[model samples]
Target: MNILHFFFGVCGNATALFLFLAPTVTFKRILKNKSTQQFSGIPYVMTLLNCLLSCWYGLPFVSPNNILVATINGTGAAIETVYVLMFLMFAPRREKVKIGGLFVFVLAVFSAVVLISLLALHGHPRKLFCGFAATIFSIIMYGSPLSIMRMVIKTKSVEYMPFLLSLFVFLCGTSWFIYGLIGRDPFVAVPNGFGCGLGALQLILYFIYYDKNKKTTDDNAIEMGPEKNPHQAQDQAQAQVKRSDKGSQNGRV
Candidate 1:
């Protein structure tokens, strides 16, 4: 059982690390294009907050400090900071201002939470408080894809939703859920359970809509073919008449 827990912990940390770095592709594209496009900084900001909270929850003061949790989430916090900074650099003026303000607000809230936890709570109380806060934030992070799902349904397309990311998220959630359950950490388990569900749903929606969109596009092309062919034939006939008239005049000459 201890071995199993260790395996799951390592796997969970690796998958979570991948999840944190997934946005690198998006940021790379933004840098190449020199535009933030329509990408929002909210997700990265929230992810950073989630990492910070998780790090706090897994601190050495806890009965059994989850070094794996702390290490991966700490790295996540640093990576997310880079992502957010790049976003601010390339984002439009309005977006820069808005995201900057949001970043500051989040920092203030995080500081207050840490201070209150440290000053008011002790030992297990502090651990529970931080754990609960981390759990809530993790759940929010899992549900962050809801907006993208809504857009997928509305547009009948999944262009903005990457299936690879969804798959990895599902895998990450499953690993963490197993680790949490075996380790008797409901705070970690519950949110990851929800994360698994949401990730699976996103993948399902992607497949359904991807096929639908492809079929729709094929049907539209087929429908346009007959309309286009008749116009093309008429133009050819007109050109043939002009050639015939020119031949007749040349014969007369």
Candidate 2:
């Protein structure tokens, strides 16, 4: 492996770890309130899936010399699992059923990938298949912020989109993208390239609305209603982040 690739890979690992842990503050609040309130469990659930697929894709037998990808994603999988489990523990019954069902679906898909790759595929074919899975999910991981992005636009507030997380997303994605470029691995490069662009866009959106958000910060602090449909509640929760404001986290991996 090229030393520079290794260096960037390490950088990616560090930043990715931060990305995984960023939700701790939000999870802390769920614990404190003894309820998930309006928080949606989907991001954590989906992140768990991305981490699983990425980890598998990075294994030596699957892709070779990508241990850094495996290490960080494996750790992320553990962290996200805890967050999802915690969300389940505190979320309302209806919310529990929804997230639980998604969790099962994630497991089923992951199992299918593993079984098909190990049993039916080999060599470059296995690598390609695993890489395809990782890439698709990684792209989905970046796209997870769509709901939050919409909320930022509609409310004219960047309150839910923390500047620091956006910053880290850019930094981490850039590092991984570079690592993938140097290593000649499109699987890692393509999705992170997408992430880098989205991260940049998010930062731009935050700045564009920051001043406006300040003027209506009080009004924008809309409380969740019990009658909110699951979709609406999840939408609000998607815009639920910006941990710098004391832990109101929402989208992204």
Cα lDDT, model 1, residue 125: 84
Q: Per-residue alpha-carbon lDDT of model 1 for 111-172, expressed as tens digits?
A: 97799888998888888888888899899888887766766676555545666677888898
Candidate 1's C-alpha runs over 4 A off are: 212-253
lDDT of each: 0.75, 0.81
**Lowest-sum lDDT 10-residue window in model 1:** 219-228
Candidate 2's C-alpha runs over 4 A off are 212-253
Top model by lDDT, which number?
A: 2
RMSD of each: 13.0, 8.5
Q: What C-alpha lDDT, on a 0 to 100 scale, does residue 241 get in candidate 2?
A: 37
lDDT of 2 by residue, 123-223 (tens): 99999999999999899988877666776677666655677777888889999999999989999999999999988988899788887425433222221
lDDT value, residue 52 of candidate 2: 99
